[model samples]
Target: MLSELQKETAKAIVNIFETGSARGDYARVTLLTGDSGHLTYGRAQTTLGSGNLHLLIKAYCATPGAAYARTLKPYLPQLADIDLRLDTDWSFRNVLKEAGGDPVMRDVQDDFFDRVYWTPALASAKRTGLGEALSAAVVYDSVVHGSWIAMRDRTTAKAGAASSAGERRWIGVYLDTRRDWLASHSNALLRKTVYRMDAFKALAASGNWSLDLPMMVRGVRIDPDALCLRPPVNASAIEVATRNLRLTDPKMSGNDVRALEEALSKEGYAINRDGIFDEGLETALKSFQRDFGLVDDGIAGPATRLMLGI
Candidate 1:
């Protein structure tokens, strides 16, 4: 069994990958193009497309003292149906974002993601004879990212079982194999996500098999302070709320627009990442909005950004 700090550190690594915060952003809602799991939300960004999002919200609504229980109860059916329209519903999205700030919602997400992701990941790690905390983390990331089984099998096939090849070597092979797969994937969005594997590879290379504290992940420090709810060094709260990307007469262009274009392309939209919010980008955004049942206003406001996972 892993120690508490090890577990939290492992989780913190993925939390940074998910929400850019070591403590996680419970209110984070993400929708990416071409992602099978659409409308991902909460601390771990559970996806609606996988029906796990329905399970998560149901658990929340059933819990006592849930701030949005009554308000969210009415939308259970749509959630159960994996309704893509919920992606664009401003009021519903607002409620979810607001509810995320509730203590009860945070507790529910902690419990839910633990039960749904962590527990299974641990089991998979134990089954593979991998006991190192970093190994557990690599497995956990695969589980959260989806297709743990496929990757596990692929790794075993290529490099032998973890028990046979040794845990460290097996994990190294897995990371390299997974990185190659992500880099060569037909989906452009998945290709951009090789950073996940790269981060894991960095941890492995550092001999952090024990997952000691004071580690740097994707430039964010994960130390005692960060795990205790303090912000990481050199990291500020992601201003996802105030960001607004839209088409203008002169065509707005910047890193934000470039990020949006990347996210849009990941969603399978045909758009170039020219860092310009031109009419073409707006048209693509509208198409994405229409596909997800959001308003086709061609605006990448809070609601739209939440959907785009940008």
Candidate 2:
């Protein structure tokens, strides 16, 4: 199971990555390059290779260790179900002894952790007052949510679907996020263990790996840079959305009457394909917004369209 510390680390670190970039990580080299990519690869080939080392490296190089656990006091219980045996006291010495002679592991250790230690927990503590809101997020009892995310990322990446970005169909998104690495070891046990050790170092450095869905640390085969981001989240101005929607049907926004008629059609109360939004449309819009968990304003804003999944 993921130790309590792992959950804290994962939440804090992922919070930074999510809110921080909308889609990216932290740190200098890799992060500086971009969230949608890696460093040496970008500089050299402008491409993320399909290699396990690169994937693990990418995760570590993006955030700080200290920051990983700094923001997760609320949801630490979710790490309970993960049966991670990596950091158990018994394996502590074994890992170190194993890495004792590996120069590459030793060399990257400090670089990996330095990034982890300095990154702030990124609770959006000061930005949106979400720091306090984050404090209230559900606290589940599971193991390795952090590690699970990491492993899941690997699975998703390996599927090469992330490269499609927002262009991916819903199935693409679902499949990429779900992957299994255990049955697909594809390599000798020693090599697998070595690669896993590297992943652990990266995980430990990020300080957030979840044991819950632990397969992520095994490795990734993603061909990143293959995808682009989804269209800017439906955050475009509501007026813009309204204008566009009105344009689609035209007769909808001529006046309050036409607009209301169109609005009613949009709200599914009446299907006046004739595009005039009338007062009835306003009433319908209000009801539609309420049902969709949006602000109950009669204005046809971006929120409405998104909820409708248009």
TM-score of each predicted structure versus truth: 0.72, 0.25
| Cα lDDT tens digits for candidate 1, 1-310 | 8999899988999888777788889997776666656667887777776566776888899889998999999988887666888877888888989999999999999987886678767866887889999999998887777656767789999999888899999999999988898878776667767888998998888888998879888777898666333322111112111335667667788888999999999989898789999988999999987886555767664335545544
Where does candidate 2 stray beyond 4 Å? Answer: 1-15, 18-268
The candidate 2 region of ten consecutive residues with least summed lDDT is: 232-241
Q: Tens digit of lDDT per residue, candidate 2, span 1-310?
A: 3344443434432222222221122221221211111221110111121121232233323334423222222212211111222123333223333432334433443333222211111211121121221111111100111122233245445544333433122122322232233224332221222232233344434532232332232222112221223211100000110232322233345553455455456657754545455455556667776774544646453224323323
Q: Which candidate's TM-score is highest?
A: 1
The TM-score measured for candidate 1 stands at 0.72
lDDT of each: 0.77, 0.29
Indicate the residue-level lDDT of 199 in model 2.
37
Which sections of candidate 1 miss by over 4 Å?
227-310
Q: Candidate 1: how many backbone clashes?
A: 3
